[model samples]
Structures are given as structure tokens and as C-alpha cells.
Target chain A: MKIAVVGKGGSGKTTTSAVLARTFARHGHDTLALDCDSNPNLGISLGIGEEATEALVSVRDAVDAGEEQHATSMDDLVSRFGVDAPDGVRLAVVTAIQNPEPDCP
Target chain B: MRVAFVGKGGVGKSSLSGSFARVLAEAGERVLAIDSDPMPGMAFSLGLEQSDAGLPDDAVEEYEEDGRQRYRLREGLTGTDAVEQYAQRAPGGVHFMQLGKARGPQWNNRRQHFGFQRLLDDLPGDGWSIVGDLPGGTRQPFLTWGRYARTFLVVIEPTPASLLTGRRLARLAETARAPRVVAIANKVREPGDAERVSSRTGLDVIGSVPFDPALADADRLGKAVLDTDPDGPTATAVRSLVQTLQKSEEQS
Candidate 1:
């Protein structure tokens, strides 16, 4: 079963989503936590850590322009962009804004 | 007025927005604060105990609106009915709603996001003030999303990264035709910090929240800043910001 957590900003949405996703994974269920927020933070929140989240390429970056995706299949979508989190929970970020800084001039 | 609180991540936008909503509500205005950020936190700032910030009853079903797929509160309500039924009341009589955040397939669906955006945009404008805490950065709000707001407030900090982000955010908000776009320098350690931000961004620096030990304690303990120290420095600055905005609205 899929569960969605929604709430106002700083309203514990990430915390709730992280907890629920972790709980499901612990219960022997195949779980995935999708981070769609441009301000993505579920990585550290879910104990995935910063390095792994930084290495994650959003699906927007993964899929090539004009590339055709199977109408009903998510295999291509997951393989190219998804990052594996701790405890068998996978993470897929939909889109992320690129930070415009490169460690100062 | 529809106001959007946006800026760099972790710049106290959520706290300021929630507090501003409370300030308006306490002043006898009907206020609805929408948590539109995906990494939601406005609910905690509003001091609500709910873990699920979406509509009550796990409402994430889809429906067809105008030949486009959209998400809705499952109570079969629209507009005012939806607001009245699903909005949760917080401290100072502010009503709160969270745009739903889902995982897996639903996360990548633009239709679902747009549906929520349409709901926010279609909200009754007159006699009601809507405050949304938008996701951090310029991309999400500028790409056909900032139109939902009449005014945009960028919360910045006394740092290179945050000021640069605030500059981009301010330009985007103005480009999107937000009638009013301004900035607030948060976590100011010195009086010059706010001046630096205003000079760099060229947008009015409406408020300056000091770096208070009480606020740090509140954040570390996951407590709302206002509730932790109602008369603290940061809260006082937030109140001044709200009052200034209200006065400007009255004048305009």
C-alpha cells in the first residue's frame, strides 16, 4: 500500500514520510520514498546521508529529451535515476533545481 | 493578499511564514496558510500536532477536471467547501492546508502537482488572505507557480549562498509579476547583515531576525519558535514584518 504525507512547510512532512517509509521497510515490505520537492531533504532524513543524495540524479536529468518511455513500465525510470537508501528503501527524485554556485570564485 | 514565502533552504522561511499567518489571523483577518513545499514543515511551525499534513482521511484519489487529471479531497467538495472541511485550525485562528506529497509513481506526476496548484489558485481571493510557504529556490515557484501569489517574500541570511539565492528569488518573483516582492534577512548577527542583503538584492529588507539562543534551542528541540519564546527577538521581528506588510496593504 502506498501512503502519502502532506503538510505545510516545516510541518514535519519529511519527518513523517521518512518515518513511514522506514516503518514499511522494517516490516518486510518493499518500500520506496520519492523525493519530489525541489528542496530535497529526505536523503538525510531517511538516514541515506548527504553524499548519497548528492550522487542521486533526478529523473529529469536521467531521461534524455525525446526518449520514449514505456507507457506502463517504470523500469527505465527507476534504473536510470533511482538511488538505493538504507534498509532496502529506494529513492527517486523527480526534479531538483541546480544550485548556481561552484564553491565561490 | 496571496503571499508566498520563499528563499534558500533552511533560511527560516517556514517559521516566518507560519508566524506571519498567525499575526494576520490574530488581527481579525481570515487567513489560510498553505504548505506548498514538498519537504513540508509549516505545520510544525504552526504548532499543529498532526503528522499528516494533507487533507484529513488520507485523501489522495484522482479525478478528471477540464479533461485533465487532478487530485482532490475525497469529500467531494470544491473551493470554499473544500477549504472549510479540510483546513485545520491552528494557534491564532489560522487555517492550514498542505499540498499532498506522495511517493513512487505519484511523485513524478505533474498532473497531481498542477491539480494542487489549481486548487490554490482558484481559492476565493476577496475577504481572505492566503499565505503559502513555497519550496526553496526560484525554479519551482517561477515556472508557472509564482502566479499563485500576489506578493513574494524571500527569506535570506547573512551569508553569500543565501543572499545569492535571495537575489535570484527576488528577480524571479518580480519577473513573474508578483505585485510585491521583498526580502527578510534572517539569523542576522550584526546590523550590517541586513544592510548587506538589501544592498545586494535591491529589494526592500522588511525584517531582520536576530540569531537568538532561544531560537536555536527551539529548533534543536523541534519546538515552534513562537511557542518556545513568544516574546523572543526573532518573534518580535516577525511581528514587525507582519505589521509592516499589513500597513502597506492598507496604504495600497
Candidate 2:
């Protein structure tokens, strides 16, 4: 089952998402938690240590910085960019805008 | 003094900004609260009954610039004029305005975004003390939404997640050449919480708001903390914050 949690900032969306993802994984479901926020911090909420969570680069940033090649398929993307969190949940950050260029569309 | 409240999502920026504006207005300052978040949150904090009100559709005009679609405030209307014409009167006589809220996937309030940006750019610097409540995350600051403000008050909480985001936001604001960037620690429970946030984010904690359940209850009830509990800890802290900001502004 797929779930998308949405709310205003600081409204417990990340906390709720992390709890739900962990619960599903512990129930024997193969869960993949996607952090799509520009300021992604789901890893920290998912029991990943702060250093490791901050070190996990988003796929968009990696590709934009020319540090990694783009994945050609969904399975390739998951394997190439996804990290294993606690409880066997796969965590992948889709995108992030760290330093946007001035007046770039 | 023009200021923008920015930080991670859910960091109590709206609460502090709304309360700060009302306090400033009560002190006889002409205060304009600009809610740059498309989520429509500042209204609730400003004690305005309508949460979704924004500038009228006719306030903006669409045009093409450099082969790109762009939006601008309608001709003959300056930013100050827009505020006077469209800003809603909140409690304590604070004038509140917002970028239109997102309606759906396809309707993303694009015009309002660009129009408000233009309006902010054209706003005069002499009259009102503008308080901008920017959207969460790094996008708006990176895009220079808070450029008009002379200072950036990055509201932070005592969490690793909040600290990381706060650090990034501070760097972005500095990179944009913002005149000043300071941290306002919120939801601080322990004695060392503010220091921890300041150390992690590398910013001076100018003001700290204690973790108050009354503020949360106000949020749940769609009411401002000042109105819900006038003498509450959160309100008292925010009033002090306003004083600090004003004093610094005077000195600078």
C-alpha cells in the first residue's frame, strides 16, 4: 500500500510518515520511503543517524552536479540511489534544491 | 525594519511572525505582514477569520518577457498601493496580505507568486515595517523571495532535522547577501536547547520561545496565541522578541 502524508510545515508530516513507513516494514511489507521535499530530512526521522542522513545525496542533486550518471530504469534508480534504513525500509530522496541559481527558471 | 521569518517547516515561524506584527502595530508602528507562503497559514496566526483570502485576480497581469511567461502587478499599482488596497485588517490593526493558496495540482497560484514578488520589489522602504513569512524549505530563499527584507530571522527548533535545515537556510541567506541572519529558537524545552541550536546552526540565538502547549492548542483551534492566552509564555516571549528586534534596529 502506498501512502502520502501532506500538511503545513511542522505539522507532523515527517513524524507521521516515518512512523507509518516503519510500521509497514515491520509488518513484513517491502516498504520504500521516498523523501520528495526540497529540504529532505526523512532519513533522520527514519532512525538513520544524523551524519548518514545528511550525507545521503538526493538523486537530482547528484545528477545535476555531474557526480553520478542517471539511472535508466526504476529498478536501476532504486538500486543506485536508495539507501537501506532501519527495519529494511529502502529510503530514496528524489530531488532537492540546495542552492538555486539566480533567476533560473 | 523589514524582516523575513524562514526556517524548516513546522518551526513556528508563522506564529512568531503574526504575533510580532500585531505587537509592532500595537506599539503604533505601521506594520505590514506579508505571508509569502502559498499554504495560507499567517491568517490564522494573525487572528483573521478568513484563512484563504489573498490579492484579487485582477491585481496581477500576465506578460511575456525574454520568451518566458511572467507575471507583474497591474499597471498604475505600486507595492505600497497594493498593500493599502488589498491587505486585510487583522486584530491589533495589523495589515495582512498573502500569496494565493494552492488549489490543486494544475492550479498552483503561479500568477500570485510572481505578482507578489513584483509587489515586494516595488514596495517602498520608508513607511511600514514589513514582516514576511516565507514558505518553508530552501526554495523560496534560494529564489530570493526574502531579498526585500533587511534581516532574516531563521526560526529553529531543538532537533537535528531542524538544525540541519536551519544551517542550510542561514548559508543560503548569507550567500544571497542578506543584511542580517539570526536564529530564533522555538519549542525549546531544556536549558541548553537554545545553545545547542545556535552551535549546530552556527547562528546566534537572539530570541527563544519556550515549548508551550497553549500555542499548540491555539493552532488546533485556528486562533492566535495572543488571543487564546494573552499572558501565556509564548505571547510573552514573542513580545520580548519584538522589543529585541526593535532595539537592534534602532542601534543599527
lDDT of 1 by residue, B26-115 (tens): 778889888866554687778776544455333345778899766654455555665676778888888888764554455464444555
Choose the strongest candidate by lDDT: 2
Q: lDDT score, residue B222, model 2?
A: 87
| DockQ, computed on Cα atoms, for candidate 2 | 0.60
Best by DockQ: 2
Question: What does DockQ give for each predicted structure?
Answer: 0.07, 0.60
TM-score of chain B of each: 0.87, 0.92
- Write down the RMSD of all candidates, one decimal each: 9.8, 2.3
The TM-scores of all predictions, comma-separated, are 0.66, 0.92
- After the best TM-score superposition of candidate 1, give how far the Cα of residue A103 lies from its true spot, in angstroms: 30
Evaluate fnat for each of the predicted models and list the values in order: 0.09, 0.63
Model 2 per-residue lDDT tens digits across residues A26-93: 99999999999988899999999788877887878767776466567777877778899999999999
* Candidate 2 residue pairs that clash: A9-B10, A10-B9, A10-B10
In candidate 2, position B58 carries an lDDT of 88
